[model samples]
Target: MTERMSAEEFRAIRHEPKPSKYRNRKTVVDGIKFDSKREAQFYASLKQLERAGQVYEVELQKPYALTVNGQLVCTYRCDFAFYDAIQKRNRVVDIKGVATKDFNIKRKLMLAVYGIDVEVIR
Candidate 1:
């Protein structure tokens, strides 16, 4: 059986006080902005990358520590992160089949922090 945190325990997490590296990663693919099949393409690419050993899956909502001025200042829980062991670097990823306008702004901000790039999955 999978053990999970209770709602009360999970509620204690102070997410709002800090910022996440992957705040909003989804946008609508139904409209002209994105083709309906684009989502399929994105997932395909992600799978291909995984099979090629270029990237490995990362669990969602897992916290990563970021240090500033020799002090651990903040934490970010990304939707997903791919680890390139060879390069010793990681790529943060967020997947959204559809998203709202507010999500767009948050996503852009997340991209700016830590020089991380953003990928809109569909």
Candidate 2:
């Protein structure tokens, strides 16, 4: 039988810092840590739009949960959510260098569950 590790111990081993194979680096702006520079740039643009009164409000890392019969199936975190006063609707945005299969599934689920179509920025 294999020995079981506690959750904390498993997380400690799982999340240990390691060099990334890709060159994309994490960046911090306005006390927010972004996964990539492209995401940070997009956030800056959102702020500019907000200041210019184009966007009513901006939120970062909006989370959506997929559930069936009150049981949680999964959770998806989008990069940004904003109310577009011009469009008179709320928009969910995601910054992606590449769209993974899991993201596609979550995007579809967001539509089916929340009826929001996620806008992707490559």
Candidate 3:
């Protein structure tokens, strides 16, 4: 087996590749991840919805911002958004273990501006 490299050698390795990759990738302004269990649940639910043909499209962890009067006014990341074929609108679905004051405020604002319904699933 090859001997382990010294800490100094590891530190000296080039890191320029990472920055280039980061720049090319899409950046999210705001977003949150579900704690493991919730994440699994959400993934399963999405699959079910797709099979049922209830969701036309699904946008996962999308970060969006709107500029108002030349200033960036509203910005918030949605957990999961599903498009309804019948309604022809986007709906935001968030999986939360518990509710908070901040969540309420942001949810309301996002719904109004984006014209989407926000649903919290526990």
- lDDT for every model? 0.57, 0.90, 0.68
Clashes of each: 0, 0, 0
Best by TM-score, which number?
2
Q: Report the CA-based lDDT of candidate 1 relative to the real structure.
A: 0.57
Per-residue lDDT of 18 in model 1: 55
Output the number of the lDDT-best candidate. 2
Query: Model 1 — which ten-residue stretch has the worst lDDT?
Result: 27-36
Clashing pairs in 2: none
State how far residue 89 of model 1 sits from its true place (Å): 4.7
Q: Compose the digit string of candidate 1's lDDT tens values, residues 23-97.
A: 433344323232234443554666677788877864444565555566665565555567866677876666565
Determine the C-alpha RMSD for candidate 1 after optimal superposition of all C-alphas. Answer: 14.4
Q: Write the per-residue lDDT of candidate 2 for residues 4-94, one digit (tens) a residue.
A: 9999999999999886555568999899999999999999888989999999768899788888678888999999999998999999999
Candidate 2's C-alpha runs over 4 A off are 1-22
TM-score, every prediction: 0.39, 0.80, 0.58
